[model samples]
Target: MTEDTLNSASIGAGALLSVLREGPARTRTELVELTGLARTTVSQRLDALLRHRWVVAADASTSSGGRPAATFAFNRAARLVLAADLGATHHRVAITDLGTTVLAERTADVPIDRGPESTLAWLAQTFTELLAESGYDLADVCGAGIGLPGPVEYLTGRPVNPPLMPGWDRFPVPEWLGERLGVPVLVDNDVNIMALGEHWGGHWGGHWAGYPEADQLIFVKIGTGIGCGIISDGRLHRGAQGAAGDIGHIRVAAADDEVVCHCGNTGCLEAFAGGAALAARITASGVLAKDSRDVVRLLGVGDPEVVHLVRQAGREIGDVLASIVNFFNPGAIVIGGDIAEAGEHLLAGVREVIYKRSLPLATRHLRIQASKLGDRAGVVGAAVMVIEHVLAPQAVDTTVTV
Candidate 1:
């Protein structure tokens, strides 16, 4: 069935989820209004939730008239979803309760580029080790969400022509990992996971908190490569070809006109701003150690040359972001990656151009901010891609009018 045509139980579950998410159903009236479900259905689902310990009967209501009915809220400690972000150099695994409160997290420097077979084995082993260490057994876990640094067809749970990570093209990641881990798996692009982490974890600069809702967020990654995640209207916009935000492949001007990219294209965005380019610029500068993170470290020391390169990269990125802001008009832009570690040096360049080039009407309320999640953003974004998979409603296949 379509997302809009969920069965009665799913609807009831949806209603219960709404209440659980909001954390209060003190009265049946509130439950009815919040879920749009029939009162009886809400009651039944809530009963099931209560039985499952997902909800609990809390304090009593005021005794103004007669005996007050007790209020209920979600039991956050009842269930947990593990979020795993798989990266080329390292992996981050976190255990989060239903409320998104992380209980225990583990990090490993296991190389993810060692092919999917070996990497999945390491990942499964890490999960097992983490569970054992945290006293959180497999039975207590609700599900596992994983994020990868590649384009993923969520419906098929496979990478599609992932440019950087070889031997992972159209790889059956979720299926393979699920069979070994014995948990329902959800997977998506790494950038998508970071966007969710920023939204859920209070990382959107804390200035725009609760203003525009978590709907229309743009998280841009500028690291070993560039990628992006677009969360519009509170949903990930994968678009046709699953390349909606694959701006890394977009052609851009490079210092060397002859610079070739892995995608067999000249002067693509990644060739300009990816981790390699950042290092190449620094290495060619003859004044730095030729590392992006070191450039970030040196930028912190006010090195003019490194700062200039990072800002230049930011401006180039902003040149591209300008086209996107003109088209999408996202509420906020989160700069994430090693270059983003330079903070305002990079963000100022982006904001300068985005505001200068984009139409005034389109950028009316646009706010650009450095990613509060930083390097962790990708890994976290990766995990979120997976969590959003089955947690979300199926495609409605019907037009929705704002």
Candidate 2:
């Protein structure tokens, strides 16, 4: 073994704990091969990890004509995680173990506003009550993951000044939750988590999770407003301002040229295709006297105008998707939103326009469809935030030696 290759941190308890939290590891031989550590160094680290019960011995395996060596795996079940989704109109909290089993879950209707103080307090109280009722102690939790709408500075675990979500600018969501939850906290844009949850355990292959190729998968969200979560090369691409996937702000001329967005802009895609927009449009259409939900039922009954509005919304969204396709060249696109209940009529419009507008090469292999995860996508994404942070946490995990 090389003298300079050994690191003192390898012998420390914290480093050992970090490795175990990440996942299972092989014998010293395998760890050395994988981590580029010397065999003796790997042995020392594993020894510490084992003594602390952070890692446990698995079944022994035969090597090339040598004595059987026992494997080591993370004690995942020993730890639990807390996750939450602070939505626009409602909020939800869940506690789960490493196996992703839900031990406690609760929902609240705080309807987050410009400032987050009241909402944050409500979250803390709700979480406390739910955990107490479920018999899970806070100290036993390994971490907390929170998802919020709008752009977020993931490095700082804070939300940016998103126009729609006022009063939450620069709010340290993770730190606030961490103080209350008493564990490391991770915060991310809601759409990002939704993409994670939906894709990680998507229904594409039924019970078992399935994945499209990792090159490019776009998750388009149409809620009160619109947004998107982008995955490329198997990683989330948070932009310079941490708002890479804010697609709702994209300009779409379909709106009356003077139609101004809440962001004070004209012709935003959200102004036309968002759920709120759909509701307003349907209300104005007069043919559908009910509400947006009724529009879905009406469209199903072959109501001509309701069908046309749904198709038109899709086209507006597709126009924006066309630009996104040309720019990112995603392999597949998943549409998610409350109005998505409109079903195939909704997708048909998006596909028709995207195919017509996007460059042939860009749209040629692009598979456009609705997110199989549907309403569960956001919640699942919240859970995945905890998993990803625990696995390859950005601020704490990566290191380079001088």
Candidate 3:
């Protein structure tokens, strides 16, 4: 059913479902105690969820000394979501359950410059293949989330005059994909999803417990282009026009040589420190490096010049970030993308600059580190977006009917 056509339930039912989804399996009595709902209201909502198959009966709780009470659990397998992370030169797709458990995934070297029609067609075909391989049908998918390597008007799910994406300005991505997939679609900036992925415990072998105390975070991506994802007070901050963390376009005072950025700006941070800049510098030095990956390979082998350039780029990025730290006072800064593969050299440079420039109050509790999820961050974040949206109280009410 279409999102607009689905029936909705009372807010009380939605609230009850949310509690079951987040907490341990609970009986009717426990739900009443947690939600402050009357016993009859809890029973009514539970019956509605059971009718929609959004929740299922579980084994009785054995804690009470008398008769065991029947419990209910959120039915994670009742629906699925498709997630895609579209990069400048590569892309990844995955199928996940409602709980964000990935069942299948695939990566390919598809370029975004190929435009939306060609790239999205390939994505649809690949998704079909992935679902078949994983023994799931198209009807099982309730929604999809896509992350693009450009500025997006999140409300419309359309790219807004993206510099690197030609012929994609104002493309109706959600309508196009939703029509083909027969599910609602959500879209956002790639780095935004990466930040969400990192925060949702999708990093470090997919097992980070997350920092409960540090509610502010900055995720910087230093690849073919540069961007950042900002989280403030435990929520993604998209700003007034969904361009909150566009740090790459910010001018840096440390840039000595004039470099023209693709956005037709000179002395931009991306021009001085992004992957393309590093690749150009390396190729100009008689090295046949094709992209940032080659530069990372050189750095891995301890190439002194490559290492030096990467570290210098880190310092430049950190220079821009120090001002951000002073203004935002984020507790953590996570570096991601191909350039971050340089590891300690990059982190050391960033730490040095941030620690040296920022005030003591800002830097005192700051934690700077490399992204543990690497390239997987975007896809995982996309999955998380779909999961959160699909399970939200309003969305759940719309999707399920009693």
TM-score of each candidate structure, all chains considered together: 0.87, 0.82, 0.94
Q: lDDT by residue for model 1 over 1-402, one digit each (tens)?
A: 232433444555534544455444466656666556788877776776677675688777865578886678767677667788776555788877665556777877766667899888877887888778888888877678887877888777798887767899988988998898777887777777777777655532465576674478888977677888888886778888666788988888444659787777787888887767778878887865554567788888888888888888888899899999898888888888666788888888888889999999878878788877665565455444544443333311111111
Angstrom error of the Cα, residue 195, model 3: value is 0.9
RMSD of each candidate relative to the true structure: 5.0, 4.9, 4.3
Clashes of each: 5, 3, 0
Worst 10 residues of 3 by lDDT: 1-10
Ten-residue region with minimum lDDT total, candidate 1: 393-402
On TM-score, the stronger of 1 and 3 is 3
For candidate 2, lDDT tens digit of each residue in 1-402? 122443544534344445545445466666666556667767776675566455688878888778898788766666678878777766668887764556778876566774688888787887778778987778777777778877889899888777768889898777776777778888888888877765665432242234345347888877777899988875677888678889899888556777888888898988888776777777787764433456666777898877888898988888888888998998878887667788888899999988988899987768787887666676667766776566442322242111
Q: Candidate 1 — which pairs collide?
A: 147-382, 186-386, 193-381, 194-381, 223-275
lDDT per residue for candidate 3 within 1-402, as digits (tens), equals 222322334336666787777667998888766666678878888898998888999988875678888999999987888999898887889998777677899999888999999999999999899999989889999888999989999999999989889989999999998889898899999999999887775332343446543468899998889999998877889988899899999998955545788998888998888888899998888886888888899888888888888899889899999999999999889999888888999888888899999999998878898887788788778988888887788767775664
After superposing candidate 1, which stretches have Cα over 4 Å from the reference?
A: 1-11, 32-42, 66-68, 202-207, 288-290, 375-402
Q: Candidate 2 has what TM-score?
A: 0.82
Candidate 1 TM-score, true structure as reference: 0.87
